[model samples]
Target: MQHFICTGGCDGESSTPGVCQAEDCKKEGEALTPCNCEDGLHGEVVEKKDEDED
Candidate 1:
């Protein structure tokens, strides 16, 4: 699964990548990053290998 998350120290996340909606992020205009890792487990995008890819 894939999703978007905010890196501006806020809890903002969306199905599509976009600006963070947190009050603080509104000022900084933080952009959401696409990732597949567990929430907060990674600051950068993480991709999981599909078993079928082997």
Candidate 2:
């Protein structure tokens, strides 16, 4: 199967079947954030950003 990716900070479909490694990308069905498909066969690593307090 193929999984999609969310290049922007939103929860979208994945082209590949795997978890998103983008620090900003939140897991599907969870929250919205900047995320992309895993880079390599291994999982991806993303830098966690702090939420702004309004």
Candidate 3:
């Protein structure tokens, strides 16, 4: 499983972060394919590993 990230502003870090669909979003409606497309304030390659794997 995977999720998008915002390396600029969000840094993929938020209390409720995943994919920002807001107007301030770097890559609105962007999918996590061909990853690392720096969309404004975003970079979609941050992987959140599963706890099960740890």
**Highest lDDT scorer:** 1
On lDDT, who's better, 1 or 2? Answer: 1
Each candidate's lDDT (Cα)? Answer: 0.63, 0.42, 0.41
C-alpha lDDT of residue 40 in model 3 = 36
Pick by TM-score: 1 or 2, better one: 1
Error of 2 at 48 (Å): 24
Off by over 4 Å in 2: 1-3, 7-14, 28-54
What lDDT is obtained when candidate 1 is compared to the true structure? 0.63
lDDT of 2 by residue, 1-54 (tens): 334544334435555455455565444344233334455321242335457433
Candidates sorted by TM-score, best first:
1, 3, 2
lDDT (10s digit) by residue, model 1, range 1-54: 578876555656777868776775532476788778665665465334345522
Q: Which prediction has more favorable TM-score, 1 or 3?
A: 1
Q: How do the residues 1-53 of candidate 3 rate in per-residue lDDT, one tens digit apiece? A: 23345432334433333554545545554432334344433334544634542
